[model samples]
Each structure stands twice: as structure tokens, then as C-alpha cells.
Target: MSKLEHAELVDGVREELITYLQNGTVNKQAVARTLDITELGIDEIDRLKRIHFCLSSDVVDFIETLQGRLRRIKTANQRDREITRGEVRGGIDWQATTRVRYTESAGDRTRFACKTPYTEYDIGENLVLKKLLWLVHSTVQEDISDINYDWRREAWPTERIAMFDRIYARNVHLNRIRDGEDIRVTRRMLNTARTARQSLYTDAYRLYDRYRRLLAGKYEDEDVSQLLSNTLVIPERLPRLFELFCIFQLLRCLSSRGLRLQPIESGAKQLAILESDQYTVDIYHDQNGGLSFHVPLSELEGIEADYIDRYQNVQRRHGELVDAFLGNDTQPSLFSGRPDLVLEVYESRAREVLTAVVLGEIKYSDNQQTFTRGLEELLKYIEFAQYEEYLSDLDIDIQGLIISDGVETNRDSPLDGEVTHISASDLISVGYPESWIPTQIR
Candidate 1:
């Protein structure tokens, strides 16, 4: 093909890419499938195949000049020679920690500072979040909205378009169709891609969390409360996200129990999260130690928004009221050093002398059937809980209960013989029975 045809083909490819990305088909394989292409080896970036490709002389020159400056900085600093402001002009900060000073071969120095919360990890967490968000945003705008398979048939060069057609047939399995039937794929394929994308997205988040732990090691001597706030972003906007995860376990548990929750706190006026009576429930807790629950009437609705909004609101309000409710000496759970949860239960009068003090740890996963590691952590906590009280002074029995979200209670499952999984959903279905929750037992 002539140069003009090649450029046009590339341009058309770009248009198709931007379109499919908008409709959530952001993967290169997915894009190739829509275009019916074979051997869509991703090179450079996904858009390289689409847009007109030209390396401007000016751009090339700029990159070469920057690289030369970087080399000079290395050479100048090699012989224990002083890097004066004049020698290191226009330079990018290699360390990326404090003030970023870039020095070029010319004697010019420009200094810029980024005030980041991170200190030890060198803003790795921030970089991860920024990169992931940018990737997601670009994918949504470019690939998701512009998906139009019909356009693949019209106004395109034979070879490139045929490549996309072939890809679509192979990956999407269009061969099963009858002679006259059109090639087609389902939303399931798109969903599978989405799931894979989400899995990768979580890796970014987990790596960020790892960066946080690395930073924690550096601030070992600092107060735990201060260290936690400094590392983790606060005014936490999503408490119910974690709660929702907990509820999923709770729901699975309820399913086994063969029972469902009824509408209890489903009213709009009573709960701010209940903006509507959809398939979601909204439960509320106040920082002032007040608690209210919302019950949804049905299923097949958005539970995430309703639960997250209400829980986050409570967490926020709690911060303001916590000082008054819990004495000044009381550690706030919002702080890093504070306990994850505090349950105040009315003690049973019949048990005057407590028997044993135990620490409980909870684990939820497929791999660890038994919470042995949790038991170890609880042992440490148990020591702290009982350290001061001698056996004679101890007047009540306390036992630690480690809850595992992934423990299988099903007698049929391999875990049934050993690991015991508690159902959070079943507990909720039972109206969050006080006895069921050890922390809340009175």
C-alpha cells in the first residue's frame, strides 16, 4: 500500500480504538477481536497501531538533549568534583525525595519541591494511585465509548480490517454461526476482560499498601497514632466499602441458614443513606455511640452506594463526637494504634469469677483453612489483656474468638472437617445477634 493508504488505515484504527475504549472494551485483545484481526501483538502502546506515526525532529532533538544532560551530571559528579549550581543546570531529581532540582549541561539550576505525605517510601503510593487512575480514565475515554463493530465493515483497507475481522472470529468464537448468520460476541467476554483489569488494578493498590508498611518501619519510634494518620489518608471517604466486603461473607452465611433479612430500617427520613427504597440496605452508627439499621425490601439493586454512604457518614461524625463520648485518654479507633473494634457488653452477674482470658483473631480466605497465625497474634494480645490482673484479681471469664471469613463450614467441602467459617450474612440475618458476635456479647 502507498504511504497515504497506510496513514489512513492507521487513523481509522485510532478512531476504532477510542470508540471501543469508551464502551469498556479497553484490552488490546478485545480491540483486535472487534476489528477481526489475527496476531495482534501489542507493541509500544495500544494506540501505536492506530494514529499516524511520525517522530518529529524537534521532539527527537529534545529527548537527545535531555539524555546528554543526564550523562553530564553523572560524569561531573564522578571525580568527587563539586556540582555547583552553575554546573548542574536544568536537571530532574533522580532521588525524587525532598526538593527536586534539575541540572542541565548549561549552568542553570531550577528547583521544585513536592510536599507529599510520604517520607520513607518516596511517594511510591502516590505514584501508584496517580498512574492507576490515569490508566483507568484514559481507557474509559478512548476505548470504552467508541466501540462500533459495524464501522469495522465500512471504509477500511482490506488487510488491516481483515486482521481485526479474523481476531474477532477467533477470540469471540464466531465460527459456530450458520452461513447467513452474522458474527457476534456477548457482554460476558467484555465482563471477563473487566474482571482481569480489576485484578491488575488491585495489584497497584496492594503495592501502594506495601509502600506504606515500608514507610512505617522508618517511623518506628513515633507514636503509633501519628504514624498511622501520616501514612494513610484520612477523612476516610469509604468505611462501608470494608463493611460491604464483610457483608458479602455475612450474606453467604445467611444463604446456608435458609433465611433472609426483612425490612427494618428502610425508611428514608430515618437514614441518610436510604435515598431510595431499592435493593440495598443502609445501617447507621453515630460517633456518639448511637446505632440504627436500615433494611432493604428487595434485591437486584445497588447495595454499595447506600451502605458506603451511611457507614462513612457515621465514621466522620464519630471523630467529632469521640472526644466527648470516650474520655480524652481513650484511644480512637480511627487512629492507627487504636483497636479495630470495641464492644461494650453488660457482664453476666452469674459469672462472678471469670475463668480464662483469651485473645481472638479473625481470618477470611480460601488458602488458610485454620487461623493459626491469627491464634498467634491473639496470644500476644491475650498476654497484654491479662498481664496486670493476677489470677486472684480476675473476677470474670473472657475468651478470644478469632473469626475467619474464608473458613468453610460446609461438611461437604474439604475445610468442613477442620476449619470453621462464620457467616457474617447469617449473623446479620439473625439481626446481628448479640450472642453471635463475641465483641458485642453482654
Candidate 2:
């Protein structure tokens, strides 16, 4: 493999290891073992090691605390389920009422309502509380991860650590229930655990696993896999891989999974709103009664004119060159004036592809970045759609080009048939300021 390819693989592995090891889940040793790298090389080795030690030592103690709370709920569950003469009652009861909760606190005279599943009351609040307790109990049995740690809090630096402590506590409660001891205690433990689990789900762990899994499949192709494993992977250079995956997954989740994004009921051609990682494209009607497309370059670096001057110049020149080629060899179509310029250089060809389009996506980033799974997905969609065939059938010979920031490679691809992929370096070195491409690049 070339030096660039080797660099990309190393980078990808480094980032993956960092994410897993530093994210409070795995120990440094585990990370090092997985990557087959020396543990000493990990910069935060000591810190991660300490965290692992603390978690292992305190896990049991934390579980006990959570189990105590669960025991109370379990006791209430047995009492609540006792069938009355004809009524199936399930509700919380104010087990005991005290005239005061704390003598030292302000307004200590306020009444204290110690609540549990109702044994007598049929009021809405009691019934709801009873049902809630049952629901929480069931949830604990089903998912200990749903345990609520909200009743516990700590200062900023230690907040996450404290939350983990709370999670461990709930696990203890779950263990009691699983062991079938102190049913009421288990019930209460489950209730608290349910609340904690819900809070954790909504507030934390934003399902990054989904993205990881979806992206994982994209690199399964032997070439990309080998490239990533042995090189320092730079995502920006080959954004097509990642971009296409995101689009495919986003569309799948939104359209098939019944996400909020939906088409209009009327005959309007709206499909769904798409969320993008690096950029977004919106299509709508123009002011002149013609179709218009909007491809936002927000969040893209190198947008300042001077930085992209060379890129744009090369792109324009590449366009002229392609035109000259078609003019000389391929006959021009009879319908449109200057058959649509399919590929044009915009700027930067060292490490990433940078291209501008009249009606398509134009990605801008510095340096060559390796291709990602997202790009593969996008390419697959285009291929399966038989984009070229569609264009040919319509008598429109639309050319598709990928202008990359790196050196244009002669890498073999199952996908690249009529669609051309060129590095910005190739376009500038050969095609820029000229009406013909270097035979080497083509």
C-alpha cells in the first residue's frame, strides 16, 4: 500500500480505540489488547485505569443501595394485588403521614406524605400511583437499564461518576427481584429503576450505536476494509462513503421506521426532510417558474474566496477541457445549448474531492480524506437507480464526476463505470487552464 493508504488505516484504528477506551466503558488494558498496541502508549492510561478500579470496587455497594429502594416497592406490590371481593384494585397508598418531615428545615410544620401502593383508596391519584408502581416494577424486570438515578446528584466534575453509581444501585435492586427475595422490595426497586432507566435513555446515550452499526457495514468491502485497517483514515477526503450511508440510513429510518418526516397527502412531490452530517441539499421551485436546487455549504471550511481560488480556477478549466473532448470525439446533443457540464473543478485537490455543481451536491474540505461507508451507500443508490441508463434513455448524456482533494488514483472500482473520479490535484496539474485532460489522468 502507498504511504497515504497506510496513514489512513492507522488513524481510523486510533480514533475507534480512543472512543471505546475513553468513554468510561472499557479499560485501557482491554483497548490495548483489542488493538494489539502497547498499553503504555495510551496518554490517559492512569486516569482510565483508576476509573476502572473504582467501578469494580464500588459496583456491589452501589447495587445494595438500589436494592433497598426496590424492596419497599416489592412489599407494596403483594399488598396491592390482593383481590378484593369483586374489584381488581391496583394503586398507591399513603402508608404513613407525619405532621413534620424535618425539624431543622424551613416550614418544618408542613405535613409529610409517605406514599406507596394504595390498599384502600380508589381515588384517581391513588389508582394512578398504584399502576405506575406496577409499571415500574415490570420495567425493572424487563430492563434494569431503565432505573432512575435522578434522586441522586453531584457537582459537575463528578456528575457522570455519580450517575454510574446510581445505575449500579439499580442493578442491585434488579438482582433481588431476579433472585425472587422480598417481593415488595423488588417491586419498589424496579419502580425506581424504571424511572432511572427512562431518564438515562432520554438524557444520555443518544444511540450512537446505530450510526456505528450502519457505518460498519459500509467498510465491509475488501478494499475499504484493507485500506482502513492499515492506513490512517481521514473521513473528509472520501466523504462519499459516509455521506451515502447517512442518507440511506436517514431515509430508511424516516420513511420505513415511521419517523416524523413524511410526505404530504396531496399529489405534491415532497418525499421527506433529510438531515446531513456535513451538508444538506434542498430542492424547490425557483422564482422564474423553473426547478431550483439548494445545496448549502455551511460548516464547510475553505469557503473564503482566496483559499478556494485555485480550486475554482481548476474546475472551470476542467470543464473547458471536458467540453473540448466531447466536442472533438462525442457528438453534441441536438436539444440543449452546451450539454450540461457534468463535472467542474472548484478548489483543492490534495486530500479530498472538491467540486461545484449547478444542480447537485458540492462538498468542500481541506486535504484528501478517505472514503467512508456513507459515500458507498450514496453511490449504490445512484448505481441501482441506473442513473446513467436513465439519462441515456432521456437522451441526456449527463456526466457524473467526483473531484477529490487528493491525487487522482487509478484504484479499481466495481461502481465507477461512466462516473469519473478525479483528484483536485489531477484536475489542476493537467486540466486547469487547458481545454484537455492529461492522458495519464484519464
Candidate 3:
């Protein structure tokens, strides 16, 4: 095949891989079935297989982290409730206390009372302990379900299967306790639970290590080192993962500012600003309005009106760009693009609302070509946002941030004094900018 044909083939396979990775319903088998393995050479087939394996492994790791966090949060909340209820139900006891004399009793010279009071067994502690046992059981059950459905069909090794079986049995024992079939919450049982959890972690790490070893051994021609360096392992999922990382960091920053943001419970792609039903920030992948602030419009003065009008125009243009980016009407070009993540701050108090938007492009690859392209894309986004009419009249500021795992350039590239470049680690470490984010919506 010619260079063009080979490039096309690679692109096609890559697109299919990305789609399979992104779809919630699609699995590895589906992706494998779609690819014409017979048409590809041995090397190509191996590369594709390695990519799929890495992607699946990364996704599992991501889910495991999420599950652990959710379990902890749920366990803590449940424990708290159980503790409170237990405390209320089982009042304090005066069993192990010294007697104290009170002065001036009606019939007797003095009355005696216990100096210190305490319960024989801390009911709250027992209740919380029981809840923790239950949590472990539930978490294990969840893992079992995931493994049975997601990994059972995969061609994993015998040792991996044995590891999973061990994990399953350990959980089954704890789950029985949760069901009250074998009612026990002893120190031994707690130790068993802790040991089981540690075992599970060890098994998971081993599985991931196995995949890494396989990739490293098989893909000799490719830069396997770069692949190993990827946090998510899969290149396709990097964008989504990057967005989530940014959102997580942003939430942490917002929490420090006394603002609480929680994921919307209804599975809607948005986060709720706690205590307010009217405000929310929507999340999306590789498009404008990924992190959008929806607020009511406030009344404004003459200068504010100009800002609002210009901001509206920018929004209109952004909408158009998004449509083009998502559609095949226009070919991929410098002018036609969308940011990997967009954060829009809306002000709504009276009537005439003003808005500020920050467009961020994320590059997970350390490849020089990819990094350069990311910079170019960011420059285009900034240039598109810098309208002379808007710049002069609008209070709205459009800032462009290019966040890359490795960027080639060192110099400052400014478009209307709005563009900035930073390493992905720095962005994650520093979190959302306090200076950039407004304290109040109005």
C-alpha cells in the first residue's frame, strides 16, 4: 500500500478503537469483531490487540478507583447515621463510675450520685462497625458483578482467575455476615475484611502489571515507553479522563472557597451547585459548554450592555464552531475547531447578563507533532475568540489554556493577551484559578 493508503488504514482503525472505547455499551469483543484481523499483517494485529488490552486495563483501573472512592463516601455516611441512631437508642450508663455526694437531700442528709458515666459497650461504635462490615460486603458484591459480566468472557490467564476466585470467596463470607445469616462482627472478622481488601488490591495490581509486560514485549517497533507512561493507558480515553481530572480539581478548588459542587444524581451530564436548584454546570467532551455556569440575567448599565452584547456574539460564534466541529460539513482546519474543555462563567442577577469563557485544550501525548498541533489548535481558538468589537466593548474575557503532558514550545504565545500554556501536572496540582473564577455569580 502507498503512504496515503497506510495512513488512511491507521486513521480508520484508530477512529473505530476510539468509538469502541467511548461507548458505554460496547465491549472489547465488539471492537475485535469489527476489525478485519485477516486483512492486517501480524505486526498490525499485535499492535491493535495491545492497544485494546491497554485500553480495557486502564478503564478497569479507572472504575476501580471510582468504586473505592464511592464506597468510602457511602461507608462514612452510613456509619455516621448508624452511630447517631445507636447513641440515641442506647443512653449513657453509670456502671463504671465513682459515687459523689450531693448536699441537702429532702429526707436524707445527702444523696449519692455517680461522678462519671459511661456505657458498658459503646453502642455507637458497635453500630458503626456493623455498618462497615455491610459496606465491605456490598462493595465486594459489586466487584463480583463487574467481574462476572465484564471480565469473565475475556481470555485472562488461570492465575488471574484464581485470584478473582479467592477475592470472591472472601467477599462471600463477609456478605453472609451482612445478611445476618452468620451474625458476627468480631475483631477477627474485621481483620479478615481488611486482609481481603488488601489481597484484592494486590491482585488488581498484578493484572495491570501483566498487561504492561505483554505490551512491552510484543510492540518492539513502537515506542512502548510512551504507551506505558500514559496515565489512562489508552490514548482515546485520555481526553475524557483529562476532563474528569480537571473537573475533580475544579471541585476541590471550589470546596475551599465554601462552594460545594456535587455530581447530579440523575445521571445528567452536569454538577449541581449545592443549596441552589437554579444553578448548575454541565459537562461535555471536546466541545464548548463543557463546564457551563447557568445563571439568571441581571440588569445592567450602558457599559455592561455592550459587554453582554459582545459576549452573546461570542457565544453565537462558538455555537457555530461546535456544530462544524461535530459535523462533516467542513473539513478539519485551523479555523474550524473546538476546545477539549470549555468553562463558561455566567452572571445573572437582574436582566443584562455578562459572561466569561475559558477554553482549554488537553494533549495527553508527549509526541512532538501532537504537542505542536495542540498549540496550534489553542492559538486558533484564541484567535477566533478575539473579536475587535468584543475586545473593546466587552467586559468578558476569553482565555485560552493549552494543557499538555509535554509541550515543545517555551515562548509565550499571546492572542489579545489571553492565551496561556501550562503543563498538565501543573494545572492539576494548582487547580482552578481563584483569580479567574468569580467569587459571586452576580
How does model 1 fare in lDDT? Answer: 0.30
What lDDT is obtained when candidate 3 is compared to the true structure?
0.40
**Model 2 C-alpha RMSD to native:** 22.1
TM, every model: 0.21, 0.21, 0.35
Per-residue lDDT tens digits of candidate 2, residues 176-199?
332222222233433443444333
Q: Largest TM-score belongs to which candidate?
A: 3
Candidate 1, residues 300-371, lDDT tens digits: the string is 135667776666566556666876787443222311111122112222323232333222343433334244
Mark the 10 consecutive residues where model 3 has the least summed lDDT.
77-86
Name the best candidate (by lDDT): 3
Regarding lDDT, does 1 or 3 come out ahead? 3
> Worst ten-residue run, lDDT, model 1?
285-294
Candidate 2 clashes: the total is 73
| Better lDDT candidate (2, 3) | 3
Q: Where does model 2 exceed 4 Å of error?
A: 1-393, 403-405, 408-442
